[model samples]
Target: MRTTDTLNVIAANSRVLVGPLVLLVVLLLLFVFALRVGIGQIISLSKKVAESKVEEQVLSQKLEILKTSEESALPLADLSLVAIPSENPALIVISQLKNLAGEKGVGLSNIEAKQTAAVASIFHTEIEVTVEGEMGSLFDFLKGLGSISPLLTLDQVIIRQESGIAKVDALIFGNFAPLPTTLPSITSPLDELTAEEKDILAKISSYSQPVFTEVTPSGPFERVDLFNF
Candidate 1:
């Protein structure tokens, strides 16, 4: 009887232990599944971080390129401005006049410059000017101004005699075109006349001499044989 009782108690303990062992096995499997899911999420986050870094690098490179382009373009724009004649049409006209007239002993007084449509459709602008000078000097000056590379015109001429001196007034026009055939790049006028521009001015110095030289007396007229009025 005692041996049977001991066997029954051992059987009951084994049944209880079987249920606990099955529950432990199920819990361990759930924990392993959760660990695997967490690892997958970590891998996905790492991939996103890598892709973001690549995007960041691409944006940085683009920004650097933009900066470099802006830096280099400034000088190129300046160069283009110099190469275009239309940028400052008035400047070319004034400069050419000053240079040419100065060389020819013709003083510029009451100069009037205006912009008009260019003679050729290809040019951006044409300058028209009204200038005053001595008649002999102006004739020579006109001939020289015409000798400019692109060509200049003596549009109109008016003459008046003032105390035996001939006063000349003329309107000159010209279209300054830049070489190397490019779209008009500059939008402003010429900054100042260049040395090359001054060379062409020598032409203004030439004048047609009158038949007789005029002599003027300062204070009073005297019966002088050597000098006469």
Candidate 2:
């Protein structure tokens, strides 16, 4: 009878221990799950913070560019001839051509201009020039014309050697900006140029200005019937 009673007490102790053991296992599982969730949240937050930092940096760079542009605004007087409005684009082109030819020792035999159709806000004119000079001087004259203000586009160039002289026939296109009714505001993005752009502007500015002569007032893009053979 005493052995039977000892067995019953041992059974009762195991029953009480089983409840606490199960509770401990449940608590361990809860702790592990909480740890995993906390780690995942931390990783997600870190990525978000990194993205925000990148976005902030990009915004700052754009703001800096805009600030620089505003600080370095250009005046109308300092603008290139192409950027300014022209009353007589053909006259400008003739003057520029005359100066370039004189500088390069090239003789201009004939020059004729015809107004082409306008495109957008700009008007276009076509010029044909016949010139005679040494081969080297002809090339130099072409190069100089390219660097001059109020940029000219060489449409076609034909060079031939005759009697030890280089004869050149060139077709060029000139762009004319329309007159502005009112002055543009200072907030224009084109008001400021980058360093590379400024370098180009400087090179063009170093060229000698073309001298204008008094000529009859002719409208922009007037049709001319002069033929150069």
* Top-TM-score structure, candidate number: 2
TM-scores, one per candidate: 0.36, 0.52
Clash pairs detected, candidate 1 = 87-188, 87-189, 88-188, 88-189, 104-205
**RMSD of candidate 1 to true structure, Å:** 19.1
C-alpha local distance difference test of each model: 0.59, 0.75
lDDT of 1 by residue, 1-229 (tens): 8999999999999998999899999999999999999999999999999977877776666566557655544334433333334443555556667777777887677666665555454344344444455777868876776543234566677777767666666666555555555553232222333455433333322221112237875866457786654
Q: Alpha carbon lDDT of residue 60, candidate 1? A: 69
Quality of model 1 by C-alpha lDDT? 0.59
Worst 10 residues of 1 by lDDT: 203-212
TM-score for predicted model 1 compared with the true structure: 0.36
